[model samples]
Target: MKEFLGTLGQTTARAYGEDLIDFSRWFEESDGIELVAGLVTTLDLRDYLSHMLTVRGLKPSTINRRLAAIRAWLQWAKRKGAINDLPVFPRHLSEPKRAPKSLDRVEEARFLRSVAREGNVRDNAAIGLMLYAGLRVSEAVSTKPSDIEIGERKGKVIVRNGKGMKRREVPINADGRGMIGPWLAKANSDYLFPGSVGGHLSPRTIQELIKKYAYQAQLDPNSVTPHVLRHTFATKILRSGVDIVTVAALLGHSRIDTTAIYTQPSWRDLERAVDGREGGNGE
Candidate 1:
């Protein structure tokens, strides 16, 4: 199992390993059964799900995540011939829909101002990719200097290491190009954002940089992560009347459903809609 997991990306491998350990402990301690991949059955997994929901009080979303990890590991084991048959996953429990968190326009302006005040050229460039191009932190750090093409009006950024090891090109709006220009001029390394050890900056380092500026800017510190910036990009672009399919393409999302989550209107938008209707009727 350990050797198989070693083939995955570092973050994914760590998470899958943790999920496996949790299931193994539950299989032995709760089921009092020897946990072997081939010998496990659908009934056993069903029981495990029941235990997680009833005793462990795990939410449907969490259980779904665990099931995904376990399923991937089991499939790998089966391919290696370590397991004869894969255990069937229980029917997934439905999770409530929650809108992705993103900063409103007012908050976004304040955040950018804070970044300009507290951050360097590199920081601004990094934030620009997330804010405009919807690049994930991992993808942003993995970007090479050669990946960007910033023209006066339009440009594109190539995400070298996107999710699932895929690559895609995203357009960099004028604002993004302007934000990235200074760093691109002075960039010394092959990487867009070089790390101390001579490669791209670590995701944690990028995250910490954003967190620092977020605090100085007086925004909600908790909401200043790289992912929130991504959500902001997606949400803002979608609200700007871009089609969901186009938004998904820009975000490098494999499925349109993932991008549809951004369509949920915010309270401000709902209020505006209501006010517009009432004003039109001269009420």
Candidate 2:
């Protein structure tokens, strides 16, 4: 397991390690078997899947992630001659398709108002980048003052390290400029949002910050996250008739299909459509 994890990047290794640990615990507790790569059978994998779905009631995505980790480890073991023959892995469980969650107009207004009311310039600026410019939390934290360029009539935020290390420029409008300008003027560190230890603020800190203001705004803190803010930005932009190609670029998505998901009607939109239909409601 250590050798397998060593081949992966640090972040990926940490996640795969956690998944492997859970699988190891389950292997010991359920079947009284040590988690050796060669000794594991197809039945063991099936039983693990059954346990996750029926006993633990974990989401398909969660189950698949763990399964993927195990599959990768097994493949690695086979290459190193630790296992001679591979077990036939079960097909991954199908995950339900749902639109990514985003704040409604009311929720956005309430949340932003709450932040504006008491949040420091740093907080407001960080949140604004996600809500307006569609920055991922990591991208927002890693951003430097030099990455942002605000002109009299136009501006853009350059995300140097987006998902998959792909770089893209997100245009900033008046609202984004207003929120970010104050902080940029006052920022002293290389990071736009500096941490206590003198590096960028961790993504976890930004998530917690969103939760804090969500609670203050009388919204469910669990429902409000930095990703939700990014979703809100994407949804709003798509609804305003922005082209999918453009939106994909703004969100740093390599595929147009990823951006197309925002075009799917939200629950609220469906509800409004049904509510406004003529003569069908009385039936």
**Stretches of candidate 1 above 4 Å error?**
1-95, 266-283
TM-score of every candidate relative to the true structure: 0.64, 0.67
Candidate 2 residues 1-283, lDDT tens each?
8989999999999999999999999998987878789878999999999999999999999999999999999999999999998898989798655568999999999998999999589998999899999999999999999999987788899999999999999999999888888898898899999889889999999999899999999999999999999999999999899899999999999999898889887777777778779546635
RMSD of each: 8.6, 7.4
Give me the overall lDDT of model 1. 0.86
TM-score between candidate 2 and the true structure: 0.67
Give Cα distance to truth, residue 266, candidate 1, Å. Answer: 4.3
lDDT tens digits by residue: candidate 1, 1-283:
7787898999999998898888988888866887777766788789888988998899998899898888998898888889887766898899756568888888898899998876488899999999989999999988888899988889999887888888889999889998898888888798988888888889999888888888887887877899999999999888789899999888989999998888877666677789888897435
Candidate 2, clashing residue pairs? none
